[model samples]
Structures are given as structure tokens and as C-alpha cells.
Target chain A: MRLAALLMLMMAAAATPAAAHAFLERAVPPVGSELATPPGQIVLTFTEGVEPLFSTIEVRDAHGSVPTGKPRLPPDNARQLVIDLPSLPGGEYTVIWHATSVDTHRTEGSYRFTVH
Target chain B: MSDIEIAAAVLRSVHVAALASLFGTLLFMAVALPVGSGTAQVRRSMRRLVLISGLAGLIAGLAWLTVQSAAIAGADSVAMALHVVPTVALRTQFGHWMLLRLFLLVVALFLMRRPGVAIQIALAGVALAVQPLLGHAGAIGGAAGAQLIASEALHLLAAGAWLGGLLPLFLAVGCLSHEMAAATCRGFTPIGLASVLLLAGTAVMQIATLMGGLPGLFGTGYGHVALLKLGLFVVLLSLAVLNRLVLTDRLAATASTRPHMRVSIAAEMVLGALVVVAAAFLASRTPGTHEQPVWPFAWRLDLGVFSDTASWAEPTIALGATAIGLAIAVAGVIWHRIRWPALGMFAAIEIVAIPHLDVLFVAAYPTSFFTSPTEFAATAIAHGARLFAADCAVCHGVEARGDGPAARSLPLPPADLTANHFRAHNDGELYWFISHGFTAPDGETAMAGFSGVLSSEAIWHLIDYLRAHNAGIAMRRTGSWPQPLPMPQFDAQCSGGRIIDLDDLRGRAALIVAVSGDEQVEPRSFDNIGAAVVVVARGIAATPTGATCIASEPQVWTALAIVLGVSLDALAGTQVLVDQDGWMRAAWRPGDAEDWTDPNTLAARLRDIQSHPIAVNMTGAQVHHH
Candidate 1:
């Protein structure tokens, strides 16, 4: 009886859903997008909750870094980081983000978008 | 590994070994010593083992904390580690768990001075249980995570009971009389059996969860260490079987076999210690699934070959022959008369089967199992298309049809990138071919290597473009997409004042309408239809009302254009039907179809898509092989 119970428990543990590692699930101005006009902000939603203090979102163009506010969590959402942007001239831009999940696992990625 | 990593691994191994030995000794004394068989000498020996192991565990546990602190603090010496040890012990989760473990050990040791077996067992068990909470098991959250943690704890306890019990059993064998020794051995058999069963079950669960599969098992450092542990365990299991089945019975019959039994048990103790060391190294390394697997073999098996009737005969004969050979080998072990004949028959079968088995394998490279670092996104595809025009188009051509101006001058013509055979090669294989260059069978340089010319990320971008280009070509020819393409994800605000993501629309049908610059779309034209209507409008001053969701994100138009194999301007009137599985099933171009705009026509299309769900080739979507 004990062996059978143990077997069932093992099966249950094996069948459970996979745990998260905080990959970027979605992004504003979406990855590899080409835009005709500039957006007001950049929003990144990850697979797991991230620590705002350790996370950063940097936007840059051909000349230098584009001015943006510090990365902050949106209202009632710990998994998202929002950055407010200023009015910018038309050019190609790259968005680089570094995120440290609440569990302390860190991941970083960069993608490009054009403002024509 | 660095010196600090090596130090941490050694300290962890020592702590685990000491704890297992301590727990095993107490457990044996409580349950498996056999009634009235605990002689003064036997009892004294057991007590001494417990004290030594318990003290060793305490010291090792403390030392482990110091080493871990040093690694985490980036410290260079013992003095530097000592300075930060207190901070680590007080401030971190690892520190808290270690403190709890140390307290349990102290209590278990104190209780051992008395005769309270249940309390001692409970304390030691809890101490061991603390380990899983500090390792990979604790990283997960939720009810399933709790269950996984429990399984890990049980696995550790079972190891302690079996491997740790060996030393105490050895002491019992040496100090007790022949009958008592045999009885003690009998008592341990069931405990060992139960531990082995639990160990096997938990090990399988861990492998399935963490190993990623066969590619991981053969490719990563963690999997290599796990394989080493498995090898040691198999040897230990064989020794255990020999002891229980053959040696124990001999010891029961006569006094002469006691020395032999002692030697066997001592060997098992050493093997178990080695297994613990391998496990420690495994724990320190990243899980196989997280690492990029560099496939080590020259050839890889592809069972998909069996789908072809012409290719079935050789592999079938090889498999059948192998089964027969194994059966004969097992029979040879059971019967002495057939031993030589069985060996010869097996050898003959192997010689025939080995060559035929080649039909099941294909040539492989070091990067054959490597997953692309870049996702199959439009930006990547766009970037790759530019790179291909600059570097690859000279020979492969702008259309990748091997008809470039330079193609006629080359020794061999470049291969067509959009052929059906192109789908057979995985993203990794294509990445390798593109970066390292392809060589024809006749020794001609079919393509030049581009490693120095392009970055690794750039190569991945190029591969993404190739896939999208091929997909685009196939889609144009088929009217419907040849394979399912994931809808490019975007964030939007819905009409009901709710924020929604394109990914959130999965498990239901959605009609994505791309409107460019003041193109009047009847917001409720496709209303009352089963599918959700998502308007991806650009250059519009106001958000459209009555749509399920609306996004003015300009990039959404560009991304959708790439999928439809058209320009940004050409994307304005194109409407795509995405099925419940999140795959783009059918598309309606501007001038091609006005019928899909009707409510009845759109609803009928939704039903058709719902009934015939596309079989998405997940590998094309994302490479999952670590």
C-alpha cells in the first residue's frame, strides 16, 4: 500500500506544470518592429515577476542613448516594467533590457525597431 | 570549474556524506539491528559511528556555508570568506536553511545520548529534508513545487537509509555471532529494497523534469555527472545483489564467510560515497535544459526514417536481431550448457545487426542540437533578409533559388533554400551550414564559411529570415499556410477598458484586421461571429469603437506584413484568420477575397478551422532540444 501511494505521488509530481524562468513574454513596439511614428513608452512583460530595482530598460539610436525614465512596475502588475520616453526624431533605435526575476535569476536581451 | 566552485562542491559532498552516514546509523539501531542482537560491542560501535558522523556533519555543514559565502561574495581567501559568513548566514535564504539544518543535527545528536529512537529518527529526517528546500527544488513555487520538494526530500532520506546503513551493517556483521549477523543482514534487506525502489522512482522524476531528454543526457556537464552517478549506482546495486543473494546465505551457513561479507559491505560504502560526490557536482551545475547542448556524437538516430517503406527493412531486421541476442545472452547466464553457443550466436547477430542499424542514423555535428539564440520574429527575419542580400545573394541569389550572377562561375551551384528538403534540416543544422559552410560529396566547396564575416547572432538572424522566406514562399503557393505560424504577439487595450495581449487570445479564434492610415473599417462588420475581432490600426487619430481589441502600435502593421509576404502598404486591407491553437490558418488579401468580409462566410471559415486543427511542427516554432 505504501509503495502504491509513493508511486502515485511520484506520478503527480512528474505531471505538474513547468516552473518559470522569467523570459520576455511580450514587449511594446513588439520585437523587431518597424514603426512610422515614435511611441510614448516602452513596456516589457516577462513570464515571471521581476525586481524593479535590479531591472533596466535602455533605448538607444545611432547618435546616443534616447532619453527615457527609470524602469518602474505598472499598477498591480509585478511582471511588467514600463519606461516613459520623450519626443524623438525619426531614426532606427535599439531597446536593450536586463531583468532579474523575483527569485534572483537574471536574463538580458536586445531587439531593434525603426522610427521612420 | 574555478577553485572556489571546486571547494564548494567538495564541502557539499562531505556534508551530504556525513549526514547520510549519521541518519543511516540511527535508523539501523532503531529498526534493523534485530531484537536482542545488539551486543555490547555492536552497540558501542554503532554509538561511535553516530557520534563521529554527526560531528563530521556539523563541521562540514559550517564549512559549506563559508565556501558558499565566499563564492557568492566574490572573495579570494579564507579571511575574506570569514568576513562575509555572518552576513550570508543571517541575510540569505541559503543561510537560513543551513542554520535550521545545523539546529536539527544538534538536537538529533543530543537525543542519541538517550534511547528515544523515534525522536532521533524524526530529527535526522527533518535535517535531511531541509536540503531540498535549499537546492533547485526550492526555486519553484506553487502546490506542484511543494510536491516536487517533497519528492526530493524523500529521495534524500531513502539514500541515507540505504547507502548510510551500509557502515552500521558492516559493524553488525563483524561484532555479532553468526546467527545474529545473518538475522541483522536479513533485517536490512527489506530496508535496502524499499530505498532502491524509492530512489529509482524519484530519480526518474528528476531526470524527466530537469534533463530535457536524450540530447541533454549526452551533451551537458550536469547530465555527464548524473551519468557518472548512475554508473557507480549500477555497480553498487550489483554488489548489493551479490551480497544479499549469495554471500549472506554463505555467512549464515558458516563462520568463514564473515570476512568476505565485511569486504563486500565496505566496498559498497566506498561506491556510495563516490555516488554522493557525483551528485554534489551535479547540484552545483546548471540543469541540462537551461544549457546549450553541444551534441558530441558523429551520428544521431532518427526514427522518422521508418515512415518510408523502402527504408524499413534494415532497421527492422537490426532491431529483431538485437532482441534475440539479448534474450540468448540472458539465457546463457541461467544455463551453463548453452553458454558458449549463446555467446557465439550473440556475436554473430551483433555483427549482422550493427551494419544494418546505420539505416537509422544520420551525420551529426557539434552544434546539431543547439537551439537558435534569436526567436523567429519579424525583426530578426527583416535583419536576416538584409544580411542575405549582402553576403549570401552573390551565389544563392536574392530569391535563394541558386540563380545568382556568381552561381554560374562557382565550381558547384548553390542549393535552393526553398526546396521541400530544406524543411528536413533543423535550425541548428542550417545555422552550422551557413556559418561553417557546406561541402559537397565530391570535395568541392559548395559554399564559403561566413564565421569571420558575420556574428553568431547575425547568423541566427539569417536563419530566421531563411525560415520566414521559405514559409512565405510556401504560403503563396498553397493559398493556405503550409504549416502553422504563430500570430505575432502584441499588447492592446480592448473596448471594454481591459488590457489584453495577443498571446491571451490563444485557445479561441481571432480575426486580425490591419488598417493603414484612415482606411474606413466597419468596426462591427464581423460582429456576432464566434471569433474575436482585433484591429491593428496605424496612422489613425482615434481608436475604433466596437472592436474586441484595438492597438495603434505601428510596428504591429510591419510585423503582420512580414507574415503575409507583402509590403507595409500592401498589409492595409489584408485580414488573417488565426485558429484556437494560436496559429495563422487562412488569409484574405485586399483584391483577392471580399467574401470573407460577410458574417456568414467568416463564421463558416471559423467552423472549418475549428474542425480541422493544424498539426503545428513545434520545432519550426521553437527549438526545444536544450
Candidate 2:
């Protein structure tokens, strides 16, 4: 119970205020990690709330796919941004993002992740 | 010598000679020769010489301009001449001044025979003043530039009064009657003395400014020529003094003195002409005052093709010879016998030793080669920006503020490209650093080498981009616009709730400002962009509310100028450009503002800002295709 509470407290603290610049805290399937199976969605947790209007998440493999739907923010966590992915075959993939924090500071980054 | 150099030298010498002749003839008429010399033939001949010299000077000036234009174009070919001549004439300060001089010369030519000769004299003075614009004085701008030009103008005028007058004075002595010749020679003594003093004072200033230090007086080719000119000038001055104090009375008292005095004056004229030629050569060579030597000269005891190490060959021998020569000269003088040869040998040894000292210093501490760009263009910076994005941005960060994502993973934090530590390095040192990647004190490579991946030209381009950014002239990739592209128009609010339309500021220069959320405008930003500044923000009140702040609706961002498809959000930390005619010129990421604070640079930018043409994109018109 204590460990659970500590983890919860840490997550809350990690969720930065909307006024601060939003930087990537962590990502689903991990950046530069080889996954045995493909993930259904890529979740990016930022240091602050990222505005959905100007922000983007693009994923490309050997070929390319038009990502569907706007990035969704969880009701419980505004700092966590979720982009749903379609089922994919095994290939090397690159994830590119343009993130605009609630305060309107924009930052972009790219990383490569693999799915076997 | 190379063909261009030889051509340039010849043209410069002829121009100087002709200019000197014209100036000297006029001065001789005014100062030395009285109104009535009872000899119409002598006066008519002098007048004819003046006319001839003026025409020759004009021709030589034109030829010098052509050669200078070709030299700047880096080719003597007819093909390049067509393009370069127009640019040099229309764009350069030197070109503007030269045209002004040519116009003045024409005016002077028309006014030459008239009683209003003062105007012609004034025009000639102005023409001489502009000559320094072709030399080092013009290369370095600002207060230093002004100082150099002033000193050089005075120096040239004094030289014209003295050296230019010598030939005409020589002729007067030969042709005039005994009484008139003595009177002319006596009358010139004071004028000559004043001009010599002026020349001495101005020469000191020119030498100090152009020769980095005393050491530079020996180290550079320019310095060697200058010393040679100085030595000749000393000899000329001695002859002038001899004539003024001793020979003047001889011309009045004895007929025998005429031949000796005339010969002496002729010698002075020749020496003076040589000095002018040396001055021309000095201007062609780059002064060592501001630049480091490319390579230290190595001396060998035994003359050979190359000497990597300093050898005790010539310098030691020269030193011994000079000491012995000086001793012999002193002994001969004591014995009431002057050894002219020994004195001459001493002077030669002293002059030779100057270069040897420079060689020793260079061989002792040689620096890496620095290849500075002869031209810095917007296109070069754009290419550099693209390369930087591909190669360096991943590590140095997008804005090169050194906050790239990979920066966290490095053992040592990547250097902040925008920091003073990097910008402070000379071009050669920077090149060396980039070619050979950084290493830690513990001998571990901090950054990977890009030498194998990129060519030298690419590396230089990267430096240009970084240098431009650091210089506050940000380079951007692309902004695709439709032909007759509608100007991205919007209203902005300042800090104090004042709304300004984009069209309202169109008639004059203005900086459409952009800053990140909560980012305050520093005092320097205001200092750098002294013109009107309009800040962009969303809604009624923005985070940075100030007197100059402008608030617009969030959807108004669609009307904002963009670069590389970067949205208004991404443009937050960048600088936006709205030219004078309401055209969206550029949206660039600015580097540090401090670099552009140089007065000379600011003055240049001010000129650019005033003259920069508005971008007019037409339908199917030229657009930046990234």
C-alpha cells in the first residue's frame, strides 16, 4: 500500500504545471527500444499539459501511414498525450513529434523505435 | 609578379605620377613662382605640362578602376568584367567615391583655365581625400575607419604639396633667371618645411594604425615597403634641407651653385617619385597589424629551398657585419675620414635584421591556417542551415542553445553553440575544432568526427550558418508562397493594450516580434531593433503585457508569416520580418543580439533595412521550395 502511494505521489509530482515548457518524460514502448510485439497506441507523458491543436505525432516505417484521429488527453491526466496506432507488421519505425505546451512554448523531437 | 598584380602596380604608379604632376605644377605656380617671371615661354610650358598631367591622371584613374574591378572579380577576363563592373559601381563605397571624384575631375577640367581656379583646387583636394577609400582605411569601418581616412588624406595632401612640387621646382630652377630662381627657391623653404612636418605627423598615425605594433613594422611585406619609402623620404628631406639652408645662398651668390642645386633637386624629385610608387605597393599588400602571419619564415645559414628550423645563416652574419661596419664608420669619422661604404653597409644590415627578427618570432610560435570567407551571402548561410539541421541540430539542439534531447545522454553536456566560449574562437581555431571533434581532458571523444561525412566546403558552410546566427542574421530554410502571395497580415497588441495593424506600419521599417510564452523582452532586444516593435499574442491580454503588446484571436495565427512550415507555435522563439511595404520578408530564428551591437555593423544593417526590397510573390511565381 505504501509503495503504491509513493508511486502515485511521484507520478503527480512528475506531471508538471501547464505554465512550464512541456518536455517528454517518458513514452509507451520506450524510445529506441525493440518490442517483441507492436503496441496498440503510443502514449507520451510530458512535463506539462501539451496543447492538442498545434501539437502532432507522426510515425513512419519503411513505408508510411496517415495517422488517424487527433491526439487524446486522458481525463485523469492532462500531461499524458495519447496517439492511437493501427495494427502494424514488423518493421523499424520513427516517431516524430511537435509539442506545444499549454503556455505555448513549442518543442520538437524525433526518435526511432522498432517492432518485431 | 602575377599579371593582375603587375598590371595593377603599373596603373597605380602612373596614376600617382600624373596626379603628383598636376598638383605640383599648380602649387609651383602659386607658391614658388611669382606672378611675373619675365619669361612667358617658361610659364606656358608649365601650363601645358599641367594640362597634359591632368588628362593623363584622368585616364590612369579610369584604368585603375578597371583593374581594381577585375582584381575584385578574381579574373582579368572580359567575360567576368560585364557582371562585376556594374556591381562594383552601384554597390560599393569605393565605387561611389570614385564616381564623385571623376565628376569633380571633369568640373575641374572645365574650370582649369578660368579665374575661378580655387574651385578646381578644392575639387582636387576632395579627390585626394577619397584615395584612402581604396586602401585599408576603408576595409575597417567605424571610428577607426574615420581616423585612418583623415590621417591618410592629410598625408596625401602634404605629399602632393612637397613631392608633387619637386619636379616643377626643379624645372623653375633650371629655366628661370638667377634673381628669380633664388627668390623662388627661398620662398618655397617655409612651405616645404610645413608640409614635411605635416607628412611626418600623419605618417606616424598611418604607421601606428596599419602596423599592428612595432613588431609588425618588421614582420610584413607591407612594412618592408613602408620602411623603404621612409628611408627614401629621409633622403629626400635631407636634400630639401640642404637646399633650404646651404644651397639657397649659393644660387644667389655664385653661378657655379646652379648646376649642383639643379642636380640635387632632380635627385630629390626621383626619390620622391619612388616613395609614391612604394606607397602604391604598400596599399596592395595586407598589413600584419590586424592579421596573424600565415606561416613563420624559416631562415637557413646555408641558402636552401626550405628551412623548417631557424638557422644561424644570414641574421648572425648580418649582425656581425653591422657591428663591424658601425665600428669602422666611427673609427674613420674619428680619424677625420668618413667611410661612406661602411655607413651604407651598417644601414643595409639594420634593414635586413628587421625581417630576421620577424622570422624568428614566426618560427618560434606558428599558428594554424585560417581561411575566412571572402564573401558571406544569405544563400551560403541557408545551405549551412540545412546542413546544420541534418548533422548538428540533433546534438547542438534546434536553435543551437544546446538543449537537444540527446544532450541529456552525453557524458559531457554538448557545448552551447550560442555561448560566448564558441563565438570567441577565431575562424581557424573553430575550423580545427570542427574538423577534429572535441575531446575531454581524460582523452575521450566528446563528439564524433564529421570529416569523413562532409566536405570542407560543407564544413565552412556550417560555420557560416552558425556565424550568421551568432551574428544576429538568422538563416531560414523555406517559406513556400503562391505567386502574388498575399502578405500574411494581422493586427498585434503591445504591452499596454495598443492594437496596431500590419498595414499601418508598412511605410516604414518594423520588427514583427515573437517571443516564447512568458519570455520578457530584454533591454538589448530594444537596443538592437531601435525601430518599431510589435509583439504577437492571443486573446485580449497576453502573458507579456506591455505598452507595445498586440493581442489577436488565436485563429489570427493563420495570417502570420512562416518558415519551413513551422506553425505559429514553433515560431514563438523566432524573429519575424515584415518589410517596409507590408510584405512578409522572413521568419527567422535569431541568435544572440549582442553580436550585431557593433556600430559599423549596425550602420550597415540600417542601410540594408532602408533599401531592402519588398518580396512580391506572384501566382506560379518564384517561391522557396524546401
Candidate 3:
């Protein structure tokens, strides 16, 4: 009953216009996952409408050198980007993404994934 | 339209229709559903009215869908009409909600076939519940959004009700008895008054959204259009008030004056429809809610071939840029989650500063291969050649000629690298190989641990070069290979920490070592004879060291030059000052020079400050007291 009261209090707090824009709830590959082979594309699902033009997502190797298709955009103008790697050897790869929503608010993020 | 744009347009258009359809159906139902009780003539007239109004609603929805795509996504006619109609039937995404709305409408229409006003009202109410979800309510999902959405939705419904109610009023006076007309006027007057209030409230909300407040009222397209919308509605409201106050009062006493009041109401309805059209246009515009760019970038592309990617290879961040980016990301996330949008927005804008950081850091390391997407492909093949040697050449022939003596014992066929079929495939297919294996991700898996062991990026690069090699393509890199050039070897040494001349230790082979602040050797060690010239860099030290302490590093390099019997000035074609922290680095360039060789001058200056306080003291030589 005590826990329920706290929950009720939380639920009663309304979402403000500003609070609606949330950062990524969960990034794919669950932040860090070692894959057998490279995935063809990089997908980012945001809490709001992301602007297609001004956003950039890049994949870099351990050496900090961006791959051939480092800062790639979405293939079909979708919210995801597909980076063509010249060759991604087995190593820890860092995916860095920066996006501005249609609302014109900018945000950036980074996550790591390794190739098995 | 490009595929994505086409998709977004189709989506926006169908949704507009779905939203507008609620008002379309409701207005017709309001006008056509009612008739006087216990009369067969009234029932027949009501059915005819129902058929006409329902048909009008259908026509309005079709027209709305046609214009909607053009409004929201700029989709041209025939194709758009074809696209949106089919989309509604598919019931996807926003379309799903529209379909659910349509289902409710069908149920309401079926229930209306059997006429109990209570039953019909219940079904219509249920249908209206789906109306908000058909969209236009999102503007209300958040508190502010809700206020705006509620005002807008009411504006739409109220306008429809006033216009719809007028149709019944006109028909009752023209075709029905005088008693029915009197009853209709009473119902119409209250409904019309309620609509005027809703329209006024909606106008206020739109102005709030577009102009934000007082100052913006005179600025922006949204502001201008809103002002215009408000002006028109004010005129319409005034006409409605005049009809209700003076004209409707006279309608009962003098039947001939009825036309004037009805004309005023019709004019108001026309103006209200114009407002609806403008409001629809406003909805299509970007939310324009936040001052910042909601989404930073508009384009995200991944061509399985990383080669064609925009801004791919070179990252444009500086040394301190990564830290700043990480800091911004963290701070922005924290601020956003905490409901501090203003602070979060500020931190988020720092992303612009971060990309520049990458550009600066990328400049520090030189490229291992030429950066050309096309030219470096041969290099990729060479890289693949190396990769093959490391991973595949054991059972396959070194030349890939298909005759490895050990291949006969293997269950899988050795890779036929020379096969035109394999070489001709796209990067996507080659990736399929690395992803699946030697058995072919297309075939089976055995493929070895190449995919498991090597990064896909390396494998892709290997394939790129291999493809070029297979294509028999060659590109000449003017400087990809090492080219010999003659440049000065400024490795010089100082005698007693002073600039020692090259001629002074000519026979002694004075290796003139240019001492930078960072050098590895002591001043005395340069007195040996070695084949290579030893140059000490004095000025290269990290911090500001006095010349006296720094001069020692060059002195030692000079001694080594004398011992080697080779003039530091005459060492070789290239004076290689630094061999990039490699094995040859310590041998070629050595010693630390962070300290100063000319400390006496500094010491005198310090003494002048400490002892004399404010006065400048002269040194012993400069004073020259006899």
C-alpha cells in the first residue's frame, strides 16, 4: 500500500511539453554485443521525429580511424544509417551518433559493439 | 518522390482524410437524422435528406484526401489520389487508427438504419470517441499540446455543427410546417452561439501556438495567417450575434424577415469553412514548437559499401573534442531525463562543437593508405592479398591458381579467387561471404573463423582491393610510394652550450645536432664514430626551458658527430629529425632538452626582482665598475 501510494504520486505527475522529448529509450544491439559478422545497417529509433538532413552517425575502429563509410546517413532516408565499411576486422567498434529532431533540438550519443 | 519522401507523404495524406472524415460524417448526420414524429411524409423526407447528406460527406472526404497530400507532402495529383485510397484500406500505422474509426462509423450508420434517437445518439457518441484518436489529439498528449489540440478539435467540430444545424433550419422553414420552423430556430440559436465560443477559443489557442505570445503576434507566417483567421472569424461572430439578437427576435413576429437572419447564418458558415482550410494547412507545417532544430541531421545513409558514405573515413574531432562530446551527451541525457529541457537543449547544441573536435584529432595521425575511394581500391586488393596469406592461402594455392597439393584432402573446395563470378559480385555479396563463411552464407557455413576473427571492416577493405585487382584496374599514386628527396639535415651541436660552427669539428666529424627541448642524449656522448649522423633536437622540448639547460643536449650530439667523423651538416640526403617513436627513433634522435642552457640571464632577472624589489638590476659585465 505504501509502494502503491508512491506509484500513484509518480503517475499523477503530468508530462510537460518539454518532458515529451526523451533520449533514446534503448539503443540497439543492447549497447554492447559481439556479433559474428557485421550488420548491414545501423538503426537508431528516437523518442521523436529526427530530422533526416542534419543528423550524422559514424562508426570508428579501435584506432579511432573512421571506416571508409564512417559518418553514414540512412539509405532510404529512414531514421537508420547503413555504414559501408571498407573492411571491418575483428575489433571493438564505436558507433557515434548526433541528431537534431524536427523540433530543432540536437542530441548526440555513442555506443560500442565488437565483431567476433 | 524519393522512396522515403513518398512514404512520409502517403502517410501524412491518408491520416488527414481519416481525421477530417469524423467531422464530415458527423455534420451530415446532424443535418439528415431528424424528422417530426407520427407522419409518413416526414419519414420519407428524412430518408431522402439522409441519402443526400451522406453522399455529400463521402464527396468531402475524397476531396480532402486529394488535397491533403498536396498540402502536407507536396504530392502531385493522380498518383497521390491513387496512393491514399489504397493506404486507407491497408490500415497501417496512422492508417490503423483511421480504419478503427471507419469501423465505428459503419456501426453507427447500421444502427441509424433503425431509428430510436437514443440508440443513434449512443452509437454516434461511441464513434466520436474514436475521433480524437484518429489524431489531432497528439497536440494534446502533453499538457500544452492537449490544450492546443482540444481547442483545435472543438473548433473543427463546432464549425461543422453550426453549418450542419443550419441545413435543418432551412429545410424546416421551407418544406415543413410553421410550428416545426419555430422549434428549429430555438435549437439553432443555442447551437450557433456555442460554436462561436468554441471558434473564439480555438483562435486564441492557434495564436498561442503560432505567435507564442505578444511579440510574435506581428511576426512569422503562422502569426500573419493567425491574425487573418482571427479577423475573419470576428466578422463571422459579429454576423451571428446580429442574427441572434435582432433578426431571430423579429422572425416570429414577422415571417417575411426570416430570409435576412438565415442569410447572416449562411455567411458565417462559409467563413468558418475557410478557417478550417487554413487550419489544415497549419497542421501540415513543422511543429515549429521548439526554437532549436529538433533533429540535427535530415539524412542517414548506409550503402552496404562503406565507400560511398558521406563523411565516412575522416572523423573531424580535435584532441579535446571527444571529452567534450562525451560530456555533452552525458549532461544532455541527464538534463533531458530530469525534465530540464532548456538545460538539455543547451547541452545538446554542443554536438556542433564535437564534430569539429573529431576533425582536429583525425589530423594528428597520418593515413596508412591513400584515402581515395576509387584509387585506393588496388591497395585494398593488396591488403586482401595479405589477408588471404594470413587466412586462406594454407590450403589454397599462394597464387590462387587452384592447385594446392593439400586441397585434395579437404571436404570443401578451396576458394577459386581467379573465378570471374566471385570477383564480379557486389560488396553486398562479398559481405554475405564473410557473414556466412567459406561454404558461402549463400551456401553453408565452414567458412573458417575469418568472420569470427577478423573485423568486417577489414574484410570489406580486402574485398574492395580484390575487386579492383580482379577488374584489372590500376591507379598511379604520385606519392603513395616512397620517393627520395634531398633536404637539409639541421642536426647541429653547441660547444660550451653556444652555437658551435660546422667547420670547427670538420675533421673530428662534428655531427651538428639541432637540439630541440626534448632530446634523449647527454652532451658528451656525441664523440663516437657511427655510420649514421646523430642529431639532437633542442627546441623540440615540451616546456619553456632556459637555453643553458637545453644546450647540453645538442653538445652531446655534437660530440657523437665528432666521434663518427661525419659532418652533421653532411650526414645524408634526408635529415630525418624524428623517426616517429619507432626502433630507429632512439638511435637516430636522442635526449631531453626541457631545461635551459642560458640560465645566467634568467637568474639575474629573478635576482633583480627578489632583492631590488621594484628596481631593475644590471649584471656584472654590463655594470663594468673599474
Best by lDDT: 1
Off by over 4 Å in 3: A1-116, B1-47, B59-92, B119-151, B177-180, B209-211, B215-217, B287-626
Clashes of 2: 20
Question: Which 10 residues in a row give candidate 2 chain A its minimum summed lDDT?
Answer: A11-20
Tens digits of per-residue lDDT for model 3 on B95-165?
44445544654655565567554554444434333443333344123455556556655765666556545
In order, candidate lDDTs are: 0.78, 0.62, 0.44
The residue-level lDDT of candidate 1 at B626 comes to 18
Please, what are the lDDT tens digits per residue for candidate 1 over residues B493-538? 6764455765577667888888777588666544455568888787
Give the CA lDDT, 0 to 100, for residue B116 in model 2: 43
Provide DockQ values for all models, in the order shown. 0.14, 0.01, 0.03
Off by over 4 Å in 2: A1-116, B37-39, B79-87, B293-626
Of the pair 2 and 3, which is ahead by lDDT? 2
Error of 3 at B592 (Å): 38
Q: Please give the ranking of all candidate structures by lDDT, highest first, separated by commas.
A: 1, 2, 3
Residue-level lDDT for B295 in candidate 1: 83
TM-score of each: 0.81, 0.44, 0.39
TM-score of 2: 0.44
